[model samples]
Target: MRSVFHGWWVVAAAFAVTFVGFGAAYTFSALFAPLQLEFAASRASVSAVFSIAGFLYFALGVVSGPLSDRWGARRLIVGGMIVLAAGLALAAAARSLTQVYVAYGLGVGLGVGLAYAPALGAVQRWFVARRGLASGLAVSGIGVGTLVLPPLAAALAQSVGWRGAYLVLAVLALVVGGGMALLVESDPARRGLTPDGAPPPASAPPPRGVALGEAVRTRRFAGLYAGCLVCGFGVFTPFAHLVPYALDHGIAPTRAALLLALIGAGSTAGRFLLGGLADRLGRLPALLSMFVGMAAAMGLWAAASDFAALAAFALAYGVFYGGWVALLPAVVADYFGGRAVSSIIGVLYTSVAFGTLVGPIAAGRAYDAAGSYLVPIVLAALANLAAAAIVAVTARAPTSSR
Candidate 1:
């Protein structure tokens, strides 16, 4: 009888790590209103808390990715979970919004930054043929976390208050996130197997691909980076403000929180279904579709006035967003190969870091100035469309030599 492949175990572990890290990070939406009420801060100032955290988590990947390449993913992931827990605990004790920015922003941001790229890099090394499916499955944790955590945070906030809610989440990060981090391994070669679990040929060479410096110099890389950076300008707006948007339309708090859940649900399905579909449909074209789909969904959001329309927008947006997230690492792996993948991915994500930092805060400021989200939503849609054009042009370029 054949033993089950260990690569799948890595996928499961990656799933849990992402679930805890992103779930905790995303719970900011649930905490948003309370923090505003507690701090007497402006919308832009409050949103900056998440923006700072988002920027750190994504931007820090540049350092963490190279470190993970040198130190192994497990160590980085475990350390990250600890840092995340500590950040949350500190945020629980914060007396002012500035403290929250330091504690939660740095803590959650640094924590996720350390773990995310390494986990993704580890998963990329474990498979070749099913890279898209595996990548999709691994990142679907973000969707699931988004689906489950915000509502849980909202409920806990109602019962125990936001500080107590942060405390509980901190404990969860230490126990669950740290525990799973143990199972991640950077390379299948250590276990005498090749990618996709085939026994290594005795003469087989180590995984081969472009180094980070060389990879970064390619036109393909430039297009991918530019596209992601442009999209970043609008990509994270909903994650930070969707609940507030729903509430502004007179939706109940619980129901409003569930809107994020709807995105998660749609995202989960997209990662699972569209990921497999991309393997058959061609990954680059599928990636292009995601940008187009997100642009269309953002249009729906701009026009939505009621619960039904908002829910539709959430589900639609979630599907493409989920697919976009799932496909990126796989596409990176496909274009560049496994060597220096973590480092390359980390660098690529800096685009997202800048966008994450600016997008939510800009949306908040726009809302504050105009008393509505219309301008930002429309801009976000346009940004996605621009991203689609970039991706389309890049797809026509030759793939990088493996």
Candidate 2:
């Protein structure tokens, strides 16, 4: 069997499953209203579920990365699919708010933690030269999921009840995600090719491994970690709140849903387009540009009152956000080398998990206290500005050569 051919196919397949799984998670903003109405829950409380899930996913990144290094990405991802399906099924049957929290927040979160970051690490192992684009393409699954799933869930919730809708999603995730996980192999070297698709040097020995603790102590690892933290704080707030805020502004619910989808659609375009660019422009420049675009998008979102403006913001933001997702990990690999990319990237993602955990709660509280979404929007815009600065400072790191 040709490992390289099968290897790329596995990477692409993993990307597709992850895109849907993460996208379903991103679509929570669209579900926020219905959930609130159904449970009569406060936005703060409901938003906490996402935070909890994100925290688990990120915190576990610390462990999952090391574990994948010891075990493999295939087991983690497959186990995650099973757990994810089970979590959703349990969530669909949840009667109280606490049950939802346990099922979706903790249970589904466990599945997410297992699957998402490991896939990135796995893809990194397969391609060295194209790692940035490969990672982006893999992560961009969230964008594709965001674009498709939320509306489908929303429409399903409208007719079938939110519980039933969740049940459907649970089944869909299980079959597709499980099948893909079964197909995923951990590395190309297992089949005898070197990283970047070139033939291995005749003298090269088999790949050596790095310890997780050693990986984090390095300066490059610390810089990437900080940059991802700032990026998470800014990136999640918009996706989490945009739909509710749009409805508050008197936009029809369906249209607001469409706007959210547009953001995902924009993200999809950005990932594919920018993945290639990161292959050429260097990861730092590509990432810095994405943060700048995110800052601008937040500013535009702050001022937006109509569909046209929101649409423009989504398209523009999606492109850069998509690009950033694609390139940042590859940048780290360039500095640290791919030998322990997953563990290194996993430590960096701990910061990202922190940002995602905090972003929505802070934004939700800001809206509740201020009685408008403006404060949160402005704050998010400023957060993006800060992210840009972090990326700028860190851009001093090596772009391609390790």
Question: For every model in order, what is the number of clashing pairs?
Answer: 0, 4
| 1-402: candidate 1 lDDT, tens digit per residue | 249788888899899988889999888887889999999998899999999989998898899999999989999999999999999999999999999999999999999999999999999999988889999999999999899989999999999999999999999899999998899999888888899988789787967888898888887888999999999989989989998898899999999988988998899899999988999889989999999999999999999989999999999999999999999999999888899999999999999999999999999999999999999999999999999898788765765533
Tens digits of per-residue lDDT for model 2 on 1-402? Answer: 555455576667677667657765766777789888878987778888788787777777777876787788889888888888888889888888888889988766788888877777778777766777777777778778878888888788788978887888788788888777777767776766666678767777656544456656655556677767877875777677888888887888878888878888888888877877778877777877887888888888888988889888887787778777778777766666667777777778889889888988888887778877787777767777787787677556533332
What lDDT does each candidate get?
Answer: 0.92, 0.77
RMSD of each: 1.4, 2.5
- Cα displacement (angstroms), candidate 1, residue 105, comes to 0.4
TM-score of each: 0.98, 0.94
Best by lDDT: 1
TM-score quality measure for candidate 1: 0.98
Query: What are the runs in model 2 whose C-alpha is more than 4 Å off?
Result: 1-4, 206-211, 397-402
